[model samples]
Target: MIKVLGDSHDKEMYDLLVEVTDLRKFVEEELHVLWKDVDEVRVECQSRHASNGNASISTSYIVVGTHGIKVPKPNMYNNTRNATMVENFLFGLEQYYEALGIVDDGAKIANASNFLHESTQLW
Candidate 1:
Protein backbone atom coordinates (compact mmCIF):
# COMPACT_ATOMS: atom_id res chain seq x y z
CA MET A 1 0.00 0.00 0.00
CA ILE A 2 0.99 3.64 -0.52
CA LYS A 3 0.77 6.11 2.33
CA VAL A 4 1.16 9.87 2.00
CA LEU A 5 1.51 12.46 4.76
CA GLY A 6 2.22 16.17 4.58
CA ASP A 7 1.22 19.62 5.71
CA SER A 8 -2.30 20.48 4.61
CA HIS A 9 -1.31 24.00 3.73
CA ASP A 10 1.41 22.98 1.31
CA LYS A 11 -0.53 21.71 -1.65
CA GLU A 12 1.88 23.05 -4.25
CA MET A 13 4.24 20.17 -3.57
CA TYR A 14 3.97 17.91 -0.60
CA ASP A 15 5.88 14.82 0.37
CA LEU A 16 4.85 11.62 -1.33
CA LEU A 17 5.81 8.47 0.50
CA VAL A 18 4.89 5.06 -0.83
CA GLU A 19 5.41 1.79 0.93
CA VAL A 20 4.74 -1.54 -0.72
CA THR A 21 4.12 -4.29 1.78
CA ASP A 22 4.45 -7.01 -0.78
CA LEU A 23 7.23 -5.65 -2.97
CA ARG A 24 7.40 -8.80 -5.05
CA LYS A 25 3.79 -8.49 -6.07
CA PHE A 26 3.99 -4.79 -6.69
CA VAL A 27 7.14 -5.16 -8.77
CA GLU A 28 5.67 -7.90 -10.90
CA GLU A 29 2.31 -6.20 -11.44
CA GLU A 30 3.00 -2.47 -11.44
CA LEU A 31 6.68 -2.15 -12.33
CA HIS A 32 6.85 -5.34 -14.40
CA VAL A 33 10.30 -5.77 -12.86
CA LEU A 34 11.07 -9.37 -12.19
CA TRP A 35 12.29 -10.31 -8.75
CA LYS A 36 11.55 -13.44 -6.83
CA ASP A 37 12.65 -12.73 -3.27
CA VAL A 38 12.22 -9.13 -2.25
CA ASP A 39 10.23 -8.56 0.90
CA GLU A 40 9.54 -4.81 1.07
CA VAL A 41 9.97 -1.61 -0.88
CA ARG A 42 9.83 1.96 0.41
CA VAL A 43 9.86 5.08 -1.70
CA GLU A 44 10.04 8.57 -0.25
CA CYS A 45 9.68 11.75 -2.24
CA GLN A 46 9.98 15.24 -0.86
CA SER A 47 9.46 18.63 -2.44
CA ARG A 48 10.14 21.97 -0.86
CA HIS A 49 9.26 25.43 -2.03
CA ALA A 50 11.85 28.09 -1.45
CA SER A 51 11.12 31.71 -0.57
CA ASN A 52 11.68 32.76 -4.18
CA GLY A 53 8.83 30.41 -5.20
CA ASN A 54 11.19 27.86 -6.66
CA ALA A 55 10.75 24.21 -5.87
CA SER A 56 13.26 21.38 -5.41
CA ILE A 57 12.41 17.72 -5.34
CA SER A 58 14.26 14.63 -4.21
CA THR A 59 13.41 10.96 -4.21
CA SER A 60 14.91 7.90 -2.53
CA TYR A 61 14.11 4.24 -2.91
CA ILE A 62 15.00 1.57 -0.38
CA VAL A 63 14.71 -2.14 -1.06
CA VAL A 64 14.77 -4.38 1.95
CA GLY A 65 15.91 -7.96 1.84
CA THR A 66 16.28 -10.39 4.69
CA HIS A 67 19.99 -9.75 4.80
CA GLY A 68 20.54 -6.06 4.12
CA ILE A 69 19.38 -2.76 2.65
CA LYS A 70 19.84 -2.06 -1.01
CA VAL A 71 20.40 1.65 -1.55
CA PRO A 72 19.79 3.17 -4.94
CA LYS A 73 21.00 6.58 -6.01
CA PRO A 74 18.74 9.40 -4.92
CA ASN A 75 17.24 11.52 -7.64
CA MET A 76 17.11 15.28 -7.35
CA TYR A 77 15.51 17.82 -9.62
CA ASN A 78 13.90 21.24 -9.72
CA ASN A 79 10.69 20.13 -11.39
CA THR A 80 7.75 17.83 -10.76
CA ARG A 81 8.78 14.37 -11.94
CA ASN A 82 8.78 12.09 -8.96
CA ALA A 83 6.53 9.22 -9.95
CA THR A 84 7.87 8.78 -13.44
CA MET A 85 11.50 9.08 -12.40
CA VAL A 86 11.11 6.64 -9.56
CA GLU A 87 9.51 4.05 -11.80
CA ASN A 88 12.12 4.46 -14.46
CA PHE A 89 14.97 4.32 -11.98
CA LEU A 90 13.67 1.08 -10.53
CA PHE A 91 13.15 -0.46 -13.92
CA GLY A 92 16.69 0.41 -14.87
CA LEU A 93 17.96 -1.00 -11.62
CA GLU A 94 16.19 -4.27 -12.23
CA GLN A 95 17.67 -4.47 -15.67
CA TYR A 96 21.13 -3.64 -14.40
CA TYR A 97 21.11 -6.45 -11.86
CA GLU A 98 19.62 -8.87 -14.31
CA ALA A 99 22.38 -8.10 -16.76
CA LEU A 100 24.93 -8.76 -14.06
CA GLY A 101 23.46 -12.21 -13.53
CA ILE A 102 22.16 -11.28 -10.12
CA VAL A 103 18.78 -12.65 -9.16
CA ASP A 104 16.95 -12.46 -5.91
CA ASP A 105 17.97 -15.39 -3.75
CA GLY A 106 15.73 -14.89 -0.77
CA ALA A 107 18.50 -12.60 0.56
CA LYS A 108 20.96 -15.44 0.26
CA ILE A 109 23.17 -13.70 -2.30
CA ALA A 110 26.47 -13.88 -0.47
CA ASN A 111 28.29 -11.62 -2.90
CA ALA A 112 26.07 -8.61 -2.37
CA SER A 113 29.12 -6.37 -2.22
CA ASN A 114 29.97 -7.23 -5.79
CA PHE A 115 26.50 -6.32 -6.95
CA LEU A 116 26.51 -3.10 -4.98
CA HIS A 117 29.85 -2.11 -6.43
CA GLU A 118 28.66 -2.77 -9.93
CA SER A 119 25.52 -0.74 -9.36
CA THR A 120 27.58 2.33 -8.51
CA GLN A 121 29.00 2.28 -11.99
CA LEU A 122 25.52 3.03 -13.28
CA TRP A 123 25.71 6.53 -11.86
Candidate 2:
Protein backbone atom coordinates (compact mmCIF):
# COMPACT_ATOMS: atom_id res chain seq x y z
CA MET A 1 0.00 0.00 0.00
CA ILE A 2 1.54 3.26 -1.11
CA LYS A 3 0.81 6.37 0.92
CA VAL A 4 1.52 10.00 0.26
CA LEU A 5 3.91 10.52 3.13
CA GLY A 6 4.40 14.31 3.09
CA ASP A 7 5.10 17.25 0.87
CA SER A 8 8.78 17.11 1.90
CA HIS A 9 11.16 15.34 4.28
CA ASP A 10 8.71 15.26 7.14
CA LYS A 11 6.33 13.21 5.05
CA GLU A 12 8.91 10.53 4.38
CA MET A 13 9.80 10.21 8.05
CA TYR A 14 6.14 9.97 8.93
CA ASP A 15 5.71 7.09 6.51
CA LEU A 16 8.61 5.13 8.03
CA LEU A 17 7.04 5.59 11.42
CA VAL A 18 3.79 4.24 10.12
CA GLU A 19 5.42 1.22 8.50
CA VAL A 20 7.30 0.26 11.65
CA THR A 21 4.16 0.65 13.68
CA ASP A 22 2.28 -1.68 11.36
CA LEU A 23 5.03 -4.29 11.26
CA ARG A 24 5.28 -4.38 15.04
CA LYS A 25 1.59 -4.96 15.40
CA PHE A 26 1.57 -7.68 12.78
CA VAL A 27 4.39 -9.60 14.45
CA GLU A 28 2.93 -9.32 17.91
CA GLU A 29 -0.52 -10.40 16.82
CA GLU A 30 0.07 -12.82 13.99
CA LEU A 31 2.95 -14.66 15.63
CA HIS A 32 1.24 -15.45 18.90
CA VAL A 33 3.18 -17.09 21.67
CA LEU A 34 2.28 -20.13 23.68
CA TRP A 35 3.06 -18.38 26.94
CA LYS A 36 3.00 -14.61 26.99
CA ASP A 37 4.81 -14.47 30.29
CA VAL A 38 7.73 -16.49 28.95
CA ASP A 39 8.87 -14.03 26.32
CA GLU A 40 10.42 -10.61 25.88
CA VAL A 41 10.61 -8.41 22.79
CA ARG A 42 12.51 -5.42 21.48
CA VAL A 43 11.64 -3.09 18.60
CA GLU A 44 13.69 -0.17 17.43
CA CYS A 45 13.04 2.42 14.75
CA GLN A 46 15.48 5.10 13.63
CA SER A 47 14.16 8.14 11.82
CA ARG A 48 15.80 11.35 10.66
CA HIS A 49 14.94 14.37 8.56
CA ALA A 50 17.65 15.71 6.28
CA SER A 51 18.62 19.37 6.13
CA ASN A 52 18.23 19.21 2.40
CA GLY A 53 14.85 17.74 3.39
CA ASN A 54 15.49 14.14 2.36
CA ALA A 55 16.06 11.92 5.34
CA SER A 56 15.32 8.20 5.52
CA ILE A 57 14.39 5.89 8.36
CA SER A 58 14.97 2.23 9.20
CA THR A 59 13.61 -0.15 11.82
CA SER A 60 14.95 -3.33 13.36
CA TYR A 61 12.78 -5.68 15.38
CA ILE A 62 13.70 -8.71 17.42
CA VAL A 63 11.44 -11.05 19.29
CA VAL A 64 12.54 -13.48 21.93
CA GLY A 65 9.85 -16.12 22.17
CA THR A 66 11.39 -17.61 25.28
CA HIS A 67 14.47 -16.92 27.35
CA GLY A 68 17.27 -16.68 24.77
CA ILE A 69 14.95 -17.92 22.06
CA LYS A 70 16.15 -17.72 18.48
CA VAL A 71 14.03 -16.70 15.53
CA PRO A 72 13.46 -19.51 13.05
CA LYS A 73 13.96 -18.96 9.37
CA PRO A 74 10.66 -18.88 7.54
CA ASN A 75 9.84 -22.03 5.63
CA MET A 76 10.10 -21.83 1.86
CA TYR A 77 6.33 -21.84 1.32
CA ASN A 78 5.66 -18.97 3.71
CA ASN A 79 7.90 -16.34 2.21
CA THR A 80 4.94 -14.04 1.64
CA ARG A 81 4.94 -12.81 5.20
CA ASN A 82 8.64 -12.09 5.15
CA ALA A 83 8.32 -10.29 1.84
CA THR A 84 5.54 -8.12 3.17
CA MET A 85 7.63 -6.98 6.09
CA VAL A 86 10.56 -6.13 3.85
CA GLU A 87 8.37 -4.28 1.40
CA ASN A 88 6.78 -2.23 4.11
CA PHE A 89 10.12 -1.27 5.61
CA LEU A 90 11.68 -0.34 2.29
CA PHE A 91 8.66 1.63 1.12
CA GLY A 92 8.73 3.72 4.24
CA LEU A 93 12.43 4.42 3.80
CA GLU A 94 11.98 5.47 0.20
CA GLN A 95 9.05 7.78 0.81
CA TYR A 96 10.84 9.45 3.71
CA TYR A 97 13.89 10.31 1.66
CA GLU A 98 11.80 11.44 -1.26
CA ALA A 99 10.16 14.11 0.86
CA LEU A 100 13.41 15.92 1.61
CA GLY A 101 12.97 18.29 -1.31
CA ILE A 102 9.33 18.91 -0.50
CA VAL A 103 9.42 19.54 3.23
CA ASP A 104 10.06 23.26 3.35
CA ASP A 105 8.10 24.37 6.41
CA GLY A 106 9.94 24.30 9.73
CA ALA A 107 6.77 23.73 11.70
CA LYS A 108 6.18 20.60 9.67
CA ILE A 109 9.24 19.03 11.22
CA ALA A 110 7.92 19.38 14.77
CA ASN A 111 4.53 18.13 13.79
CA ALA A 112 6.01 15.27 11.81
CA SER A 113 8.31 14.17 14.60
CA ASN A 114 5.56 14.37 17.18
CA PHE A 115 3.19 12.31 15.10
CA LEU A 116 5.82 9.69 14.30
CA HIS A 117 7.00 9.41 17.91
CA GLU A 118 3.49 9.10 19.27
CA SER A 119 2.31 6.72 16.59
CA THR A 120 5.25 4.33 16.69
CA GLN A 121 5.89 3.89 20.39
CA LEU A 122 6.94 0.27 19.86
CA TRP A 123 9.38 0.42 22.79
TM-scores for all candidates? 0.23, 0.22
Candidate 1, residue 59: how far the Cα is off, in Å: 26
* lDDT of model 2 at position 68: 40
| Residues 1-123, model 1: lDDT tens digits | 123344453443433222344565676675544332232231112222123232212122223333443545323222334798657655665554454444444222332233333345344
Clashing pairs in 2: 6-11, 8-99, 8-102, 8-103, 9-99, 12-96, 53-100, 54-100
What tens digits encode model 2's per-residue C-alpha lDDT throughout 1-123? 133434566777889999999999988876676344334321112222222333322121122224443433222221234787656644554344334332333433333333233334232
Clashes of each: 0, 8
Candidate 2: stretches off by over 4 Å: 1-7, 33-123
Winner by lDDT: 2
Q: Give lDDT: candidate 1, residue 25.
A: 60
Question: lDDT for model 1, on a 0 to 1 scale?
Answer: 0.39
Candidate 1 ranges with C-alpha deviation above 4 Å: 1-81, 105-123
